[model samples]
Target: MTHHTDLLIIGAGILGLSHAYAAAKRGLKVKVFERTATPLGASVRNFGQALVTGQPPGPMLDLARQSRDIWGQWAQLANLQLKRNGSYLFARTEAEEHLLEAFCAGRAEEYGYRVNLLQGAAMNDLYGGQFRHHRAALHGLDDQQLYSREALPALINYLCRELKVEFHFSTLVRDIEPGQLHSTAGSFRGEQIIVCSGHDYQTLLAEQIAELNPQICHLQMLRARPKVDLNLQHALLTGLSCVHYGAFADLPEAAPVQAQILRDVPHLHEHGIHLLISPTPYGELIIGDSHHYGSDPSPFNAEQVDNWMIELAEQTLGCQIQVVERWQGVYGSRGPGPFSFLRAADGVSVALMHTGVGMSVGPAMAERNITELWGEV
Candidate 1:
């Protein structure tokens, strides 16, 4: 049977769901298709950090802030367990610390986001007194983190019950042409088509669409059960992971990058790590992240990264951690620009560039762009 709707969204990940919610809210009949029985893509695979601290100043940063506000509002309306752990980024070295201070100085007032520089006893006291090894660090107050594992299920349930969006799971789309998409189940046609396919861009769009050289980075992260209460209530980041998040890996002078990693985030860089510890209302901690960038990297989940994260957790929060869960995530790779919205043709748009922070800006992006295209919603 052919499924006809006003709008058809391919790839029911965070991006797809965003479109579903936005379109439906605008009174557009929407149908979303997911290739997996469950959302196994980066949308649900991430730590669910609606990141705002690391976004560089400009439109991307503005979009992130807007999306973040929407996430909080939606979660509250939907009654989901969302954690508003303000995010922090710090420099562990002198040079790195200076750079962060410079960054904070310029945009501190514009966004009304506070970025504080702490040191000596002040720094120690602020960060649990365990990470006294840092020279300087920047903290951003007001941003929050989401548990993707929980948010996806909650959002999907809410959308189905309230918005009347149709979701077809375990349905792989074999082809997407001008006005139709072919799936294993049947054909889906709509007035407008938005391709939300993440890393699978190659399959749906041809070389012309993908010539932007969209790639992906594979990462390994683990979830651990803490032996003791961390008493930590923020998304913690250090120089090592912050540098990558700051999108400055390929800087001409590599020394500044090193200084930034070690000086700004000594605690994290010394161990090559950063952690997003959201003490699940259930008492477990979600600690992660080690990065490997490539179009298609080798299988990268390492017991070593897990061990390293656990050890860092112990050091940062002064508590022992037990390994309870482990996993890997694939995020869109860096490209010429921050994000891309290629209007391949009238009524056919391709949304790309989650930048590992899609959760931060997905909904607003969907609502604004789709509404502009459709002219009513």
Candidate 2:
């Protein structure tokens, strides 16, 4: 059998869907194939928080801001459920507090978002005694969170209904056979192809692109159901605790500095501890996670890590939350910045990543790259 599409996208994760939506919006014939029965990869298996604050300055932050807007527009268009819950980063120690102050003061211009400085009784009053150890907190007005699990499925439905994106689920591609795709379902030929494989990089292409410089990390995330009514409206992050939050402390040749920062920031842990205390519209609070890094992620779930996260959440939220669900999300870290846009010999090029932030950056990156490639939109 033979089928032709103007744009063929592999991997129906968020990135693939973003690209497909962009191309279809441009009126291009687009088709997407995914190895899974449902589009459940890192995209759905995340905190679903469209984080805008705490990102370092530069193009990455710009892309994050842009993606947030796109997500908003798409949510409205698709009538998807989006929680505009704002986010807060708390500093537990004097040094951590200072760092938060510096962060709020430093990146205001570039990020175009105001990081409100909350300290002393104000911090304690708003967040309760849970953050009593901290001297300050960085609260961003424009920084909002999302429920990606709901968002992705809704986005997929919108793509099909409005943009006419053809999605082939459970159709695993065995090979990119020249100008054609050999899949479990059948064969598909296209004028152009875009491979959007996330961590399964080796499955899509023959050679590793230098720009990809992808690093893989395995993270554990938990969803919690509180015993009582929880009225948390904002996403929360602890200073000096989560690896992603205190990552700057571990820069190359900066162990001493990292140690000093950790010392000053008592909550900082080397294993990386960040929590998303956002209550879903359904009344479940999602908290997570700890990080484990390697070229290949080990198939192991550490109970100690889960315990540590639960302890952290119980202390922060002032409630003994019940862990209803837990899962692992593998992300491609240390990439050539954002995602890789590759053009292969078969005229099939695509973007790939291993994390959810790819959703936060998808629209701008997809629009820019797809326009450059197909010369249509």
Candidate 3:
């Protein structure tokens, strides 16, 4: 059978869904095709942190803020369990503190951010004195989180029921030419075709993706059920994050912080280990993550990486955590940018390499793309 629509979106991750939502809202007949039976990719396998504050200044940061606002607005319509808990980046060393101070001072006004340097009483109040780690912290008041497991399904439902967008699951696209997409199920034709294939580069546009030579970043993440209710007030980050996130890298103090990490925790620097803990509404904590980048990464999760992450979590949070679940995610990375959008053919656009900020910037990117394609929507 042949199906036709105004806009056809490939890949059902956050990026695809965002485009579908934008197009449908603009009264376009939209059909989405997913290669898998269900949504399982970097979009779902993440901390679900819509971190706006950590994005480097300029268009990327603006896109994050816009996407965060869109997520908040859609949470009500989609009935998603969204948490606006913000984020606290704790500094365990003086060098880290210096980095945070420099970041807060340099970029706050330019980005219109609300960040404060916390110490003494202010620092203790973050998790009710649970983090008596003996150093300073930076509080970002704009960050937010959502339960991706819940939010993804809710979003798909909303798009189907309210916006009348059609979705075809378990459909693999074998070929794409001009305005038509040939898949295992059938041929889908549309006025415009957008491909949001995350890490499956070779499947769709092999030549272009290969030429770009994008690096694949595999991350290890885990979820632990706390013995008692931790009642975390915000998403927690560690000093290592200063070097990991791009927004902090440009600061003059970042080099010193990186040097300190290399000196004290050489293994962490070697494996790109950083600690980010987000407490779910159900009293369970989602912790992660280590970045291992290459063209082909090992399938096995490194036990030492897990141990390092858990150990850092316990040390920073000042509590013991028993991990209940562990998983890994692989995403496309091509240095510092919001995403890579390539025009494969006439009316055919490829969007990928979000670099792990899809949840934070996907919606805004979709909006911009839609407007570019059809204007004013």
Task: Output the number of the TM-score-best candidate.
Answer: 3
**Model 2 misplaced regions, further than 4 Å:** 124-134, 209-213, 241-257, 260-270, 354-356
Local accuracy of candidate 1 as per-residue lDDT tens digits, 1-377: 67678998988888888888888888889988888887888887787777776665667677788888888877976677776757666565565665666555655566555567676777788746665767765766656777777788888888888988888899988887767889987998888888888877567776645678867777767777767666556677665554565522333333686765566546556433565555555667777776666677567466766777777667655568887878777877676676677878766788887377788777778877777777664
Total backbone clashes of model 1? 13
Query: Best to worst by lDDT, what's the order?
Result: 3, 1, 2
Question: How do the residues 1-377 of candidate 2 rate in per-residue lDDT, one tens digit apiece?
Answer: 97988888888777888888778888999889998888777777777776667555666567777777888888799998776656777665555566665555554654566568888788778845656665677776666667777878888899998888888998989888556899988998887888887777567674754446576778888889877665667777766432353223333323443466567534435556565566677888888877766667778888878888888788766678899998887777667655677777767675765344776677777877787876765
TM for every model, in the order presented, reads: 0.87, 0.89, 0.97
Candidate 1 lDDT (Cα, whole model)?
A: 0.72
Candidate 2 residue-wise lDDT at 93:
54
lDDT of each: 0.72, 0.72, 0.86
Whole-model lDDT, candidate 3? Answer: 0.86
For model 1, the superposed segments whose C-alpha errors exceed 4 Å read 118-137, 247-257, 260-276
At residue 221, what lDDT does model 1 achieve? 72
